[model samples]
Target chain A: MAATASLQTAPVPEGAPITVCEVGPRDGFQIEAAFIPTAKKIEIINALFASGIRAMQVTSFVSPRAVPQLADAEAVLAGIDRPEGALITALIPNLKGAERAAGCGVDAVHTVVSASETHNLKNVNRSIDASLKDFEAVFTLLDNSGIAVEGGIATAFGCPFEGIVPPEQVARIAKRYQDLGATSVGLGDTTGMATPATVRAAVRAIRAEAPGLGIGLHFHNTRGVGLACVMTGLAEGVTHYDASVGGLGGCPFAAGATGNICTEDLIYLLNESGYDTGVDLDRLVGAARLTQATLGRELPGQVLKSGPRLRRYDPGLTATAAG
Target chain B: MAATASLQTAPVPEGAPITVCEVGPRDGFQIEAAFIPTAKKIEIINALFASGIRAMQVTSFVSPRAVPQLADAEAVLAGIDRPEGALITALIPNLKGAERAAGCGVDAVHTVVSASETHNLKNVNRSIDASLKDFEAVFTLLDNSGIAVEGGIATAFGCPFEGIVPPEQVARIAKRYQDLGATSVGLGDTTGMATPATVRAAVRAIRAEAPGLGIGLHFHNTRGVGLACVMTGLAEGVTHYDASVGGLGGCPFAAGATGNICTEDLIYLLNESGYDTGVDLDRLVGAARLTQATLGRELPGQVLKSGPRLRRYDPGLTATAAG
Candidate 1:
């Protein structure tokens, strides 16, 4: 267990509060080919909240024709329970999406801008500056409506098309978002290109630029280091994290691969590391199992399959040979 | 990408050296139900060496009747290629296994003892003290044979049956191994129960108790925090790690799940973080693909499916919609 050889890091604080925001219904479901029924989506969301999940990016408000998977965003928002202290949010593309989300009474809306130019153009069919310009209107619409806005910078780690995004570029966007009244800014590992070094650089740059904005890490477990990135995030003192249930999403480029980090797995890590996530592991696993069954596929969530670490076994069970 | 927050870890040094040892053939293959052909095993072992793996636990010298899958351990040792600087080792149960390993010209031998009494009794059918008594003969046989000995403490973190395996229990075993001429001690996450707290505690205890013994970390990604555990190891300044190709192994208790941390993913994290591993990720992926093809089912490695983080795409392919 002694891993002391390189990378001298300070101790990770125990008993700290980490906000594990569930983005499964939006980020995880957006790429799923099958449209989960509106009622089913509400059931899953309600289950998550019952398990002590306080912050969640519940769904995305987009054009139904463009993304039919989330065409029932408003229905899902209406059908779900409003638990005390639960912060329900959604991803919004433009002013229309923002208006729809506000009408549905969401607590907040997330806005994204890619750090790299080419990726920005491909993802949203607009330049980074144009996306920012469009967000100004969305921000204004929700300014006095009690809806907090979180600015999400996609491809903040590295862009597949334009590798090694500079930390300064991400910081500039964060500065703009802060100036536009964003309560927090999230760094999205859109293609799972985030590494410890890149994460350190981008985090340090943003802290130097926008000291007032809260930082949330939204990482994808694409390359198997998603939770490892979360480890770095915890070390860096960032509390907010984004995860999906049962690892429901897959990358558009990497077919049949996991997308965002699994929510159950994230909670397991946080709870074990002495960070208070306020989640019940059994209930969260149940939620993950529900998602996996609803999707009719094997998920990439290891904890959900393995159960909790201390889960006992009968020694009499066979196949336990080692030598 | 910015992850600065709670843990005040110092800077992770770039361009440092980390020794990533492959244990797929031994710890991984021993658990497989089907017996891989000797030639195929040799091919996979050779491919791993060709990909610049400097250290490996090639096979185990247990009774053929005990573990049929690894019955051809001697044949595998004889048939595989040994490139210069590749340290080949194997698991030895007792003096007889040590003698067989010495006969196979292994560079080292790893001996196992569970930190928990129940797990020890279930794993090797002996009490903890009885297992140590058995290892005494192993150390004596390999003392002057030019084969280094590594003590492996199973369930060093926590145990499924016993719940929590105290760090003192693990360190006491490590001290016994050190006193018995073991050059290093490896803390094994046999049931994927290692957390950062347990890892830190065990590592600190060993360092305090046996200052001269080198430490190696053997972690399982069963609960999805295996790589995160590695992050803790790096911060603690320990360099040696054990992994499996394609994440071939699965926990015996958890049906159809990943066991060891993926070698390719570990190499990718280490290499991207500026640690020198001398591994070509593409070659490692090729090796994983070979294992997957050989197994005729999917393995749990994420980098094996997602490729390297900066892997480029043409954007001409469809399904790239986002906002």
Candidate 2:
């Protein structure tokens, strides 16, 4: 198929991998039962950077008690020395978080609001309008500090509390974020309730509503539809995606909610489908194995547990192949 | 999208749920390690039937030592007494197996051959030509004995051992089975290597080769493309599908292979998409629970653990309200 007009046409350097943002430290850690140490969080961020994932979301700057897992966000940012040209993003839930992210000399501050009213109220204890008001200030503060601002629309696909969320509503919210000078908009499957049809429809509507705004898809594999949703986004000309390292993370309200799509598996799918997701599968596996060892548990990522699809028989060459 | 020929023109009664054949007890169990007892096998099949799944694959008649899981196949067939209209199928690998299936009074005898020569050799321990020769007698016996015969093409999509089985080759093998008077044919993704593009190509090719034979898709969820393959099959006008209860089956060769597409999940998808799958989601979950309890282990179906998209609240009132 010809390249769709919605995708950026800037030709990638021959065989260069697509830029995959590893959100395990942020998205994955934020939902876990254990409060991972800032030092270990820094180790994960550095490991992911070494894995060829240039873009990483290391920590969320929520209130210390709200997501205790990320209470040491500042310490994590202080400990890690990022590579040149690497983008490290932090999830900023309010103006306070945005100020901290800007002060940390981070590449980006990402603020999340929900498309569903019930979820928005349940998530941040604020109405949608109240959350938007907070985000507006966060955007302005980040812009004045010359830091990039990414607005995330949670429950962009569907809401567990309120069943189906209209695509137009998601687009409307995203457009408002763009109007407020956000650099990019991320669509999140907060509840893992998206089908390929719904994902495509929402992405198409968002693109039409906010032209030239980079739209990224963040999915949870709750219903085992994470990669399928990613494929839908890919078919709709989306290149940027957010994946957790070991499929770690779950929505507090979505019953039986699972983790985000595994980075290794997502990279495998993209590589197999002939996309350039510039991630090294082996390196991602190494990071996952490290995280798994740290946590003393097996993760849900298939590729990490099963190994890469094709194993080559070379005594000297250690390169594994895709299935 | 407008309904295709099967959806638009099938002569079945209006509002009747489409049938899904649960193949877990038979096809799934035969391949893997879990050696479930005859009582447990009957329990699983009975639970599935109670879940509004009228048809199921109860067992396979391969040699006892070859597949020890179904060693008590005859006992399993004799044990379960289900609804009158409910049909149970048995997979028979050769003429002796078919004779046993006929003696056991199965509703259908399913014989499988491979589309790829290398896959056939690896799978059945016989070449494609030898398998065809064996299937000829099986088909002839079924034709004379008034037993329904369904032909399955293993590795119809692609093979792990032998890459990318040609569509024409699949059609040719399917035609040979049809010529021998097989009543229907099922395209097997033995390795779960099918994509939408490949499924569309193979289905279209096979339809042209054998217009009268009913074609079903038996897919594995190994590569996470099972549902995508199903959608392609649905688009190509296929009405019958074979899924395992709780996604039970996987290819022995494919180490990371999860089970086949779960029957409850597939039904949920079809129902949500406005297609009618007669199985009740809650009842399907109940069946999955029973199987899991019997085996004392967790199975892979997600919808069973997590309630259906449409949760039932005030069940008694809802039933009365429907009345």
Candidate 3:
């Protein structure tokens, strides 16, 4: 080869260990039309926990009338056998939800604040300032409850109702959450409007503002750039990511919103890219299959349908001899 | 509003202009079981050309018995309205295919060689060495035809029959293609087995061996890392990419292979990331819609369903006042 001498240069830097926070039970189930049986939900959650996933958002403590699909959040959270050192989180919309989640002994409670004011009003029935007040109330309610709080800024990239969300707006909300005692903050592409540039800019802006806060990303595969956004986030030193099994999850309020990044697929990417996630691929696929069985339909995960890339095929002796 | 002080730093660099080579006509149609009418193929290609796409892989001149979907390669080449300054290319398997393409006046003729020997044998019924010999014969046939040649190395990242192809093998094939008068070499993830790390390593290795060659990428969204792999390629200074409109391509020979990176989605990413691709988003979506209509089903592209991110949403004065 004429120029093989220059091939000695390493192309990719070894990335740090990444934490994949499985949000299938909460985010994936919340949007399903058919109600999943409580037992089936517990089964899937248990299977996912047994798959060596260290963290997960188990369910959301929202109003039963608002999200009937996850109305059995309390029962589902209480039924699963909590693994040692696992961070089991729950989505909470208000101080009441936070209190209920803390009572359920969840490791963390996640709250949402939209970067777009129009989206914030539509999503939480409050302005950004009102949401900040609610977050303060939630913090007060969770005081000394030993439960960590994660502030999630939705539509951090762009909004369906408001075209381009300013990164400065996201940074302001993130800073307020940090000052209000949030342990971490997550940026969400609620409408799947994020590109690599916007994702990187959002991360940098938020990181520059909340220098000491842990940052995470929740991406939708709506535009098919979910993993690409994750790659840019990784390059910018983001380690916490939220993914769904079987590529499940979508927003009913957000038009054209689709599934979140598939957990198995994200794991495959991170593992192949030299980032340790400590999750078992086979077990994750098993969980995805169980999900499909429960849902009575095929899911959108690639690794669930196509086995892992490292799977070996026995070409037999004749093929080897030919090679 | 606490942390909006330092929002002036640009997070993403202004990347160089990128070339998006639309391959829906050839790669997308190749695996489709239903035969698209030849007129419809020409219609979509013409629409794509009018959408400001500067290059496209129009069709493949392969054995009709092998791929009946694209049997009308010559008719399609003659029918499409070739735009000024557009580089319309065709996929050619061997000397005969190359001669047919040259006679049809294609701007370029593309050939394939697999990095995995098993994949090579399965794809073309020839060994790697035999494929090289065929390339040589094709080069001789097109020597004075004024048609450039593109050598596409299939299974360049990993193979279903042979797991984890070595970068050295890909570099060797690329080197030989460069020596044999290939103006460019495209690395194909035929099975969608490439991750960012492997994609970067392959690009670096291949670039090392063939410094003067124009390198392009053909990615499959099989494992959901298609765009991520493209992001890595962009970081490594690769300017050419192959995307299928509506993400409508899959490799029948490569088990579990799915659609290619969607052209509309790729343009959205590149344009949003500050790279000029000279593609019209709305017209591209129209072409994708035409493809979906032709197939009598919805395709996998998100931009086709969600519209572009820059699409303005009229919140009305009432909504703004409420916010």
lDDT by candidate, in order shown? 0.84, 0.72, 0.80
TM-score, cand. 1? 0.95
Models, CA RMSD each: 5.1, 6.8, 7.5
Residues B219-304 of candidate 2 have per-residue lDDT tens digits of 77765657656665665676777898878876554464466887877876666555667667788888888877876777767666
- Order the candidate numbers by lDDT, best to worst: 1, 3, 2
Q: Enumerate residue pairs that collide in model 2.
A: A17-A278, A18-A276, A18-A277, A18-A278
Worst 10 residues of 3 chain B by lDDT: B1-10
DockQ score for model 1: 0.57
TM-score of candidate 2's A chain against the true A chain: 0.90
Say which candidate scores most in TM-score: 1
lDDT of 1 by residue, A1-323 (tens): 00100111333468867788888888888877887899899989998998988888889988899889999988898899988877888888899999999999988888888998988888888899999999999989988888888888998998878888999999999999989988688888888888888887888788888886778888888899998898887777777888988876667767656788999999999998888889999999999888888888888898888998888887776525442
A best-first ranking of the candidates according to their TM-score comes to: 1, 3, 2
In candidate 3, stretches whose alpha carbon ends up further than 4 angstroms from where it belongs are A1-15, A253-257, A313-323, B1-15, B253-257, B312-323
lDDT of 1 at B74: 90
Give per-residue CA lDDT, model 2, range A235-319, as digits (tens).
Answer: 5767678889977776443355456878887877666555666567898889998998878787777667545544322223221
Q: Of the pair 1 and 3, which is ahead by TM-score?
A: 1
